[model samples]
Target: MSDSLSEAWDFLTQAAAEQDDGCRIPGRSWVPPILEDLVLAARNTSLSRYYPFTSHARLRFSTGPESWIGNGDDLAVGIALVPEGRYLVCTQASHDAPVFVRLETADADEAAAMAEHLVNAGS
Candidate 1:
């Protein structure tokens, strides 16, 4: 790993570790896995070349006047792993493929579980 990449990895792992009671919290440091069979740029990249973070807080609200004043709570959550400096968490152009959205939660395990589910649900 290059010095910069290593540093980035350390920073990500450390950030994950520092969390105590939130979705960002992780039981163990995340080591980016190699998805060789997948058609993803992250698959070819090294772990050090990526930065890991939680994608939380997905919300939907009404734009109408009633909703503007008070609306129901419509939200969903998922977590993802993306390459360094990338915004996309994961994508599936294939039909019937499960889309991995960011986890909206305050629990670490829940976020991890969502991430795992995304990996298991392949295109």
Candidate 2:
């Protein structure tokens, strides 16, 4: 992995480990392999030359009866890689939720095209 990607992974792993709620930490095993591959592929694209990429882990929290409410306690953990502010590969997991990786785009076709490009770029 590139230095930036490695650093981001390390930072997120450390942060997750420090969380009081162990269930909120997605853990390395929860991260899909495609995420790392996508980030590396993005580095080879022209977009990376103009805009820097960043990776982060997002923790959801709820304070009220509703899950969406603003709360200080963690509910789940999600991680994402933003490549040049254009493409996003992310996943979320919790003790009570299923883990699924997603590539965000305008539509399914767009997402498929981007995924193809990233895969080709890596090859």
Candidate 3:
């Protein structure tokens, strides 16, 4: 893994360790393999190459009363990256939720292109 990717993984593992409460917290094992592959795909994109912090992101684990769209009281794991601006890659930690990315004021077209690349790579 690249240095940035390794740093991201370290941050995630640290977060998991610190936030371990008795409940099911998502650690490295909880992350789906495809999500990591998607992250790798995102890192290799030209758009990511321009940003120094593309893969150097923070990982968060939330388990509270915060209302989620589809997840109710389930653990949430989110990877927040500041590429052009800020984008979040999130999924329910314990549930079979689909991993999705939310971009802020960054390049929407670039995000779309990256998603397309991920899909193509998967196929």
Candidate 4:
């Protein structure tokens, strides 16, 4: 994992431990819903560590036609390999407005697993 990912993972795992429901990470000051969902899913699943990146690049996604506005940032993203499959989740939100997170999957199974998990975890 890159230092940013490791830092983010540590920050999130700690937040989950402290809040049960997550609070924003300090210093960074933004919590895109996809990251929030990941935090909650980690909390729900007892996620305790960070996974190394399979490869390196600036991980970004459009979220396509699903695009909408909200309260914080223009975009944010994260990646993970779950039992279901590899996933790239993205979000766009701003302050005092609605937020939306979109999940991109390497395959349909991952898509199904993530959709179910997001709902089940109440994200």
The best candidate by lDDT is 3
Q: What's model 2's overall lDDT?
A: 0.36
Judge candidate 4 at residue 21 and give its lDDT.
29
What digit string (tens of lDDT, one per residue) describes model 4 on residues 1-123?
A: 233544545565454345422323444423222333444454333222322111121122222312333211223333433333245543324334543546766553444345445434544
Local accuracy of candidate 1 as per-residue lDDT tens digits, 1-123 = 232434444544454444322333353424233111111222133321233323332111111212223432111222333322122333434324666544444333443444445444531
26-108 per-residue lDDT for model 2 (tens digits): 66344333333333344344323222223343222222222333322332222242322233433334445665555564232
Backbone collision tally, model 4: 6
The better-scoring model by lDDT among 1 and 2 is 2
lDDT of each: 0.32, 0.36, 0.38, 0.37
Reference-based TM-score of each model: 0.28, 0.26, 0.23, 0.25
State the lDDT at 47 in candidate 3.
24
What's model 4's TM-score?
0.25
Find the number of clashing residue pairs for candidate 3.
0
Highest-TM-score candidate: 1
Candidate with more favorable, higher TM-score: 1 or 3: 1
lDDT of candidate model 4 versus the reference: 0.37
lDDT of 3 at 36: 33
